[model samples]
Target: MIRDNQKSQRIFWSCILPEPLIAKYGLSFAACNFSFNLMSGGGFDKVYSSLPVYVGGEMDSDAFADERFELVYDKLRKRGGVFQKLAVLKEQWMIFRKIPRGAFVWLYNLNILNALLFVLLKVFRPSVQLNIIVLDFTPVKKGWGANSVFLRLINMAHGRICLASSPLFKSQNSVVLPGVVPQSKEEIPVISNPKASFLLSGVLLKEISQIELVLKVFAKLPQCELHITGTKGDEILLEHYAAIYNNIHWHGQLPFANYLELMHSVTFQLSTRDINYPENECNFPSKIIEALLHNRAIVSTIHYPQLNGLNYFEVPSDEEGLINRIQEICELSKSDMYTYVNQGARVREIFNTEIWNRQMAKLEANK
Candidate 1:
């Protein structure tokens, strides 16, 4: 239990819970889960004495073993129906009421649920310091004009904004977070596969075209194998390619450990997110960070100014460019491949937990 004196120091952190909870709920997104674990591992819980208030899914009390971070979830919403929305609102209100005034609160994303919480805290508990961690930005397009406007309004409410990628609109209060490095217990040695093996993992629905492009490229390269993982998006489309090409394998939503194991075994971590997409401007491919931490070489089309110095093979967002890059990597000698893998080690020093803690400390001091 938290001591009374520690009340003001306590941080109420709201995000999607860990991978197990996400998998249990059948949620399609896992990037937030990766970020949450990185935050916890990087000492966010210990530094701020944080209490995790989960959004988007029901909590499993017995699932998590971390006693340091208490999990809060809406129980009534688990019943599910027309009343679920009302139940969630009521639960959010109750949670907000319980928060001590002048406390620090860190919210993970800029979704509708968090937008409501921002208004509630701003109006009712004005002293509560609020920070929004933007993992992905809603694209400002013709159909999404209202959402973009709403997001901007919500941004105005934040005392400070921590962004994973560059926001479309600049804000004095906002800071682009140095990407988190996943904690590794032991160094994972780069696997020297005679036949190049590539792993592509993330939200498949958003990058269906990119995935399809990779599938077509892999179909021609019979010697190289491509492994795809994440929640199912278009099963029929994926299965169609998987059927035609024995080298292309799709594993829909593997356990976190199994996913990491697969990543470790692959020759390169593949990211095919189109750099031309407007949404890409506001979001960073977190998979690149994970690959770097594991000492694996990355072949990616997505590039941002923040990742300017990172060691990764940049490819044009096209089939010919991807195929050429893959073939080039495949032709590299074992010694040269090892050198490429070792280059990723620089990421560990560049984006360490110490840097993360220091940034968080600065944010806390600003309050």
Candidate 2:
């Protein structure tokens, strides 16, 4: 636990916001925001002073005001042009200058703005302890290239690197963070429907091939149902699949609450990221965390090294394997399904907020 005296001594450069702000603005990155909030220990009221960086939407300064921090937000239009970029850089510099010396500074990612702030603090506010929370890693194509050099410089600047996935490369300063189960604002009951139903949700733009694979498999098994929800996908392709397969349902996008309700209603949450994709190794599937929290089984291709002991179905990253696994799960009796739910509940307990805070404390200690 962070001591009361140290509570106000920390600052978070955040893209995450309170639920009201999210609801009003219709923010697109809810999953990312939820994970970042939990990892940074900032969802609690007034937990840490925060500066709201670009959150992919416009904001009303009044609507953003909350007891949840000494909130500082830029009023300029986001992504306007060069002027806006200059303004943002100036604002960030001023914000860092005002922060108390020796304060703990937490950053969201290795974006340009955060990288600039990291450099600024190192040069000017040397006493401020810097730490960055890296949710995913994107490797540079050229080894020892300019981009790689910049990444290395920023990596060394932070006192500790909090990674949401297993480190792509070994780093004594890096720690793998446990997945956090988001707390629902309202009670969402788990449905006990005996029918075999599965959910596939998230940003679907990059998973077009995986979506097609799942659709083809479900087409063969008309008895089982597959629900697809989320945004940014090949809509025409999805519509074509939905038209042909009665069991495949494609819901374009849904409200956060509705998404959660649908998640709990399903028997299994599916993740079909291609294992060969380079990004797969660097990114942990947030849906797996949500599935565990909702006491639902998971069928995934990506292997989570940190969660090796947890009980969940793993399928080969191929169409035939996925088909077989789905068939196997569908044949399971009610008692067998209950066993998966029990294991998922155990996962929820294992990655609770108390455990999240303890891992965060390790980063602070490194500072």
Candidate 3:
């Protein structure tokens, strides 16, 4: 499947995809990272091949999702299939020379393994216009800056940084990249279901969303059905909870497009990130962005100032608060629900394509 002219490709997008291959260019972390690096702004218009690794929180969550594969046949669950993972590594290796040395190489991550790969790619073609974008960051002691090895690497690199607008990392020349929401004519999903439906996506990490709390809170909603997706997110625990609740459907992981398309079938969306985590202080939730783009009313606990004026319902970071919010949403009349949906629809104008292109162009040093 390697194109001989692949090397001739000018722009290269580099990021680490989740191992166990949860969402291949879909609604999972893969899609979020892809959108930021390649799909959003003008990056997609140019010629580029995506290079992703399988590591970080994704790799850890994959362990929880693939626990069965690891427990029964312990050795086989070696991160991901060797052949599939090597494909990305191999793709990057083969296309090194084809891409101009000084051409833009947008590095979307700086994980343990990905950092090494970035080094190799830069060495292969040292003149790469390196630009790094970190989706999630945890500053030490609620401060904007952290004196970590990763931060040191980020500072050492002469690339522009993109993060959620905050005073914390301003010294790094950080640009606000809240997330791209196109003002597309695509109709907002029509939810005519008599009962409410909910979506829970992203890696089901205990340190973050507390998947069990969500499940427990969701179980209390008799008029609501919760649909779950995303990569290897604590499948065993999910199944246990699913077994107890008849309405909870575990769709596992689906392609991002498929996930979005299915929005019409659901009434509302959910984004839950524990604010207690140090990382939550600096990181913005892409799930919130995705829900807004889909024009669905979201019940979330994560805080993003970008949605400050928007009509989103921010609940307390607790199971009781989540339960109360979902109850409130379910109680809304059809007309009221539509009003909430339209409120989210208004957010599309906030993320203009022209504005995004300007930011990306600046990062690329485009005059």
How far in Å is the alpha carbon of 118 misplaced in model 2?
0.9
Candidate 2, residues 88-110, lDDT tens digits: the string is 66667766777678777766655
- Per-residue CA lDDT of candidate 3, range 1-367, in tens? 1223234222434433333344443324644354443343444323333333332122334433431122111222244567445545554444454456656555554544345446666676666656666666666654434336566565545554454654545345457666666535667654454358788877778756678888888788756898887765889988887888888988776765677766656766777877777767656777776676666777778767667667776777677877887787788788777665645445666665556655656655532
Off by over 4 Å in 1: 1-7, 10-12, 41-68, 142-146, 157-167, 191-195, 206-209
Model 3 residue pairs with clashes? 7-98, 16-53, 26-256, 27-256, 144-168
List CA RMSD, all candidates. 3.9, 3.6, 8.2
Better of 2 and 3 by TM-score: 2
| Model 2 misplaced stretches (Cα beyond 4 Å) | 5-8, 18-32, 35-58, 61-63, 69-72, 143-150, 157-170, 182-194, 207-209, 342-344
Model 1 pairs whose backbones collide: none
Write down the TM-score for model 2: 0.85
Tell me model 3's lDDT, rounded to 2 decimals: 0.59
The reply for model 3, stretches above 4 Å from the true place, is 1-10, 16-29, 40-102, 113-128, 138-147, 157-163, 166-172, 181-195, 255-258, 333-336, 343-345, 364-367
Q: Candidate 1's error at 83, in angstroms?
A: 1.3
If scored against the real structure, what TM-score would every candidate get? 0.84, 0.85, 0.70
